[model samples]
Target: MTLEEQKEIQQLKQWLMQSQHQAVISGCNDILRRTREDMRVSQHILKEVLYLKAVAYRLLADVNSAIETLNELISYFPDYARAFQELGYCYLASDRKRAAHSFYQATRFNPALLTAWLQLEKMYKADNQSQALALCQQQIAFLTSLPRALLGATDLMHEGQLHKAEQVCRQFLASNEHHPEAMMLLAEIGIQLKVYSDAEFLLESCVTLYPDNDRAAAAYQNLLSKLGKFPDAVSVAKKRLQYAPESFTVKVGLAHALVGVGELEQAIDIYRELLSENEDRPAVWVALGHALKAKGDTREAVNAYERAIVFADDFGDAYWSLANTKTYRFSDELLAKMILLVDAEATKLDDEIHICFALGKGFEDSADPTRAFAYYERGNRRKKRTLQFDIAKTEKALQAQQQAFTKGCFNKTQGCQAADPIFIVGLPRAGSTLLEQILASHSQVDGTMELHDILGIASSLSHQATPYPLNVSALSNETLSKLGEQYLRQTRAYRQGAPFFIDKMPNNFIHIGLIKKILPNAKIIDARRNPMDCCFSGFKQLFGEGQEFSYSLNDIGRYYNAYEKLMDHWHSVLPGEILTVQHEEVLDDLEAQVKRILAFCGLTFEEACLAFHKTKRVIKTPSSEQVRQPIYKTGMGQWKPFESYLDELKDVLPARS
Candidate 1:
C-alpha cells in the first residue's frame, strides 16, 4: 500500500478504537471505494480495512452489516482468522451454533487465537461437549503458558509478518537459549526464509536436547524430508514411531520417509496395514497409490487413486495423481465432478491448484488445447502467488560459479577420482530421468532416485563465511577428496551393488563445478531439450518441492537461459568433462543415443539398455509412466498447441534456430 493509503487505514483504526463507529464505517467505505480499482492496494491492507469496518458495524448494533462485511472479507482472504472471529461475535446472540462454528473455524486457521479458544470453551461447556471442551481447555492452557513475547511472535508469524516474528523469537531466545519451543519457532521462521541449514541445525538441537518432545522431532524430520535427506528422515520417523507406537500420523510419516528412501515395499505394507484398520482415509489411499505407482503397478495404483476419490470425492491430489500416471483417463462423470470441486468456494487453495493442473492434463488429453491452456495458466498463476522466485538471484549465483571455477582453479588441485557416480543434470522435464532409465538398464549401472547428497554438501558449505561455489576454490586437495568420499558414503543407502550409480538430481546442473572439484571422474550428463518444450513442460508440472521458478513462465525462461550459460562455463573451464544429451535426438533414434550415452560413460554396449522400457524398477518423477513404455514422439512439439498463450515465455527465451 502507498503511504497515503496506510495513513488512511491508521486513521480508520483510531476511529474504531475511539468508538466513533459511524465515522469508522464511513472512513473504511471511502478507503475501499478509492482503492477498489487500484491494483497497488495489497490484500493485507484491504483485509485490515474490511475487518475494521466489520468491528465498527458490530459495535453499532448493525449485526447484519457486520456479518456481510466479514463474509466479504473472507471471500477475498479465505484464511483471515480475525474475520471469522468477528463473524462469531456477530452471530453469538442470534445463532449460538453458527457462532460456535465460526469460532471453531477461526481457531482452525490460527490456533493462537486465544479469544476464539476461550469462547469455544464456554460454548462446548454449555453444550456438554466433553471432548471439544477438553481440547479447547488444552489449547487455552498452552496459549496462556507461553511468554508474552512468544505469543506476540506466534501472532505475527500467523499474520505473515515473518521478519517481525523472527525478531521477536530471536529476542526471546537471546536469554533463554535452550528453550525448545522458542528454537522451534525460530526454526520455522528460518524454513520460511529458505534458510534450510540453519533451520535444520535449530531443530536438530531441539530434538537432541529434548528427544521426548514429539513436536520437535516431527519438525526436524519434516525439515530433513524437505532438504531431501530421506535416510535421516527415516531415522527421525522411526524414533518418533518408537515414542508413539500406535500413532497413525507418525506411522504415515514414517511410511512417507520410507517411500522417499526407495523402500517401496515397506511403505506399501504400512499403507495396507493402516488401510485395513481404517478404510476411509483418502490421503492414506493416495499415499498407497504413489507407492504402487513407483513400484510399477500401474493398474493397482489407479485402483487406489480411484478409491481415494470414492472415499473423499473432493480429494484433488488423488485426481492429480491419476493424471500424473499419464495413462489414466478421467471419465466424463469424474471430470464433471472435478470441475465442480475446482469451482467450489469450500475447495482449498491446495486442492484447487492440483485440480487445475489435473484438469489441464485432462483437457490436453481430450485435444482441447484452449481449455487445457486455461487451466494450466490458472494453476500456474495461483501457485506463483504462494512462492518467492527471484530470477536475478539465480543469475547472480550462476555468474558467481562461472567466476569461481576458472580453468586455473581445477589445475591447482586433484580430486578423489571416484568413477562410481554418473550425474544426470539439467532443468527438470528435460528427459534426465529417461536418460537414467536407459543407463540403469545396463548391467553395470544402478539408477538411484534423484540423490540429494551433492545438494546437501553444497548446503553444508553454504554455511561458511565465503559459501559454496566461491568457497570451493579455497578447499585443499585432501579436503576435496574427503568431500567426494563423504558424498559416496552419504548416498550409499540408495545404491544396491552396482559399480556405477546415477544421481539424477536435475538441479545439480547448478553445482557442476562442485561435482568436478570433489569427484573428478564422476560423469556429468547435461540433459538438453528444446527451450520451448522444456520451459512449457516445467510450467505445467507441480513439483512436490523446490522448483519455484517453474510456476512462472518468465522465471522458468530466465532460469533456462542462466542454466545454459552456466553449463557453457562448465564446458569451457573443464573441457570434455561433461556430455550433453538432447532429448529430441534420443527420440529420433533411441538405440544410437543409448549407445552414445554408454560410450560417454565408458560402459560397453548392452542389450538391456535397448529394452529399457521392459526394465522393472521403482521410478519416481512425473515421467515415470512415460519412461516405462516404449519411446514415443507425441511428447515432442507439445508446446505448439499452447503457443498462443506463451508470449511471456517467448519474450524472455532466446529466439530458437
Candidate 2:
C-alpha cells in the first residue's frame, strides 16, 4: 500500500477502537474503493481493510453485514484466524455449534488464539464434553505458562510475520539469555530464512546446555538431516531415543535417519514394527515405499505405494512416488482417480502440485503430449509461486565464480592429494547418475548417493566474510588440505572399502572451484545432455528437495546457461582437469564412453562397467529404474513433442552446439 493508504488504515483502526463504528466502516469502504483496481495494493493491506470493516459492522449491530464482510474476507484469505474468531463471536448467541466449529478452526490455524481456546473450553464444559474440556484446559495452561514475549513471538510467527517474530525473539533473548524456548524460536526463524549455519549453532548450543530438552534435540536432528549430515543426524536420533525409548515419533525419526545413512534393512524393520503397532498411517507407508525403492525392490515398493493410496486416495506423494519410479505406468482407473483429486477444492496446494506432475507423467506414458504438457505447465507454475528462486541472483553467483577462480588461484594452492573421490557434477536429469552407475560397476569403485559434504563445506565458507569461490583464493594450503580431509572423513560412512568412490551430486557443478582447491587430486566429470531434453525432463520431475531452479522453465534454462558458462570458464583455466561426458555420445557407444570415463579416473577398463545395468547396487535417484536396464534411445529427443510449448525455455537456453 502507498503511505497515504497505510495512514488511512491506521485511522480506521483508531476509529474502530474509539467506537466510531460508522466512521470506521465508511473510511474502510472508501479505501477499498480507491485501491480495488490498484495491482500495487498488497494482500496484507486488503485483508486489514476488510477485517476492519467487518469489526466496525459487528460493533454497529449489523450482524448480517458483518457476516457478509467476513465471508468476503475469508474468500481471499481463508486461513485468516482472526476472521474465523470474529465469525465465532457473531454466531455465539444464535448458533452454538457453528460458534464452536469456528472457534476450533481459529485455534487450528493459530494456536496462540487464547480467547478462542477459552471459549471452546467454556462451551465444552457446558456440553459435558469432559475430554475436549480437558484438552482445551491443557492447551490454555501450556500457552499461559510461556513468557509473554515468547508467546507474542509465537503468535507473530504463526501469522507469517517472521521478521517481527525474530525481532521479538532476539529482544527476549537479549534479556533472558540461554532461555531454551527463546533460542529454539530464534533458530526456527533462522531455518525459515535459510541461514542454516546460524540455526545449527543456536540449536546445538540449546541442546548442549539443556540436554533434557527433547524439543531442542528434535529440532537439531531435523536440521542435521536437512543438511545431509546423516551420520550426525543418526547420532542425535539415537540420543533422543535414549531419552524417550518408547516414543513413536522419535523411533520414526531414527528410522528416517537410518535410511539416510544407507542402513536400509534396519530402517525397513523399524518401519514395519511401527506399522504393526499403528497400521493406518499413510505417511509411514510412503516412507517405507521410498526405502524399498532405494533397496532395489521395485515391485514391493509399488505395492507399498498402492497401499498408501488405498488408505488415503488423496495422498499425492504416494501417487507421485509411483510416477517418479520412471518405470511405473498408471492404469486408466488410477489416472481417473488422480484427476478427481486434482480437481478437488479441499486438496492442499502441495498435494495438488504432486498430483499434477504425476498426471503429467501418466498422460505422457499414454502418448498424450498435449495433455501431459498442460499438467506439467500447471504444476510448474504452481510450484514456482511457492518457491523463492531468482535466476538473476544465480547468474550473478556463477559470474562471481568465473571472476574469482582464475589460473593464478589454482597455481598457489597445494590441495590434499587423495584420489579417492570422483566428482560427477551437472544439472539434474542430465545422466550424471548413469555415469555414476557405470563407474560404480567397476570392482574398485564405490558408488555413494549424492553426498552433501562438499556442499556443506561450501555453505560454511559462504557464511564467512569472504564467501565461497572468492574465499577459496584466500585459504592457506594447510586449510585446503584439512578441508579436503574433512570431506573424506565425512563421506567415509557412505563408502565400503573402495579405492575410489563417486560423489554424484549434480548441483556440485557450482562448487567445482571449492572441490579443486580442497581435493585437487579428485577427478571431475561434467555430465552433459541436450538442453531441450534435460530442461524439459527437469520441468516434469518433482524433486524431494533443493533444485529450486527446476520448478520453472525459464529458471532452468537460465540456470543451464549459467552452468555452461561457468563450466567453460573452468575448462579455460584448468585445461585437462575435468572431463565432459555427453549423454548422447554415451548412448551412441556405451562401451567407448565407459572406457573413456574409466581412463580419465585413472582406472583400467572393466567388463563390469559395460554391463552397468546388471550391477545390483542400490540406486536412489529417479533414474534408478531406467539405469537398471540396458541402454535405450527412447529418452533421446523426448522434448520434441512438447517443443511448441517450450519457447520460453528455448529463448533463454544457450544455442545447441
The prediction achieving the highest TM-score against the true structure is 1
Residue-by-residue lDDT tens digits, candidate 2, 134-201: 99999999899999999999888777778999999999999999999999989988887777889999
Per-model TM values vs. the true structure: 0.89, 0.87
What is the total number of backbone clashes in candidate 2?
0
Q: Point out where model 2 deviates above 4 Å.
A: 1-141, 158-160, 654-657
Whole-model lDDT, model 2: 0.89
Candidate 1 stretches greater than 4 Å from native:
1-16, 19-109, 116-138
Predicted candidate 1 versus true structure: per-residue lDDT over 35-57, tens digit per residue: 68786677678889899999999
What are the lDDT scores of the predictions, listed in order?
0.89, 0.89
- Model 2 vs truth, CA RMSD: 3.9
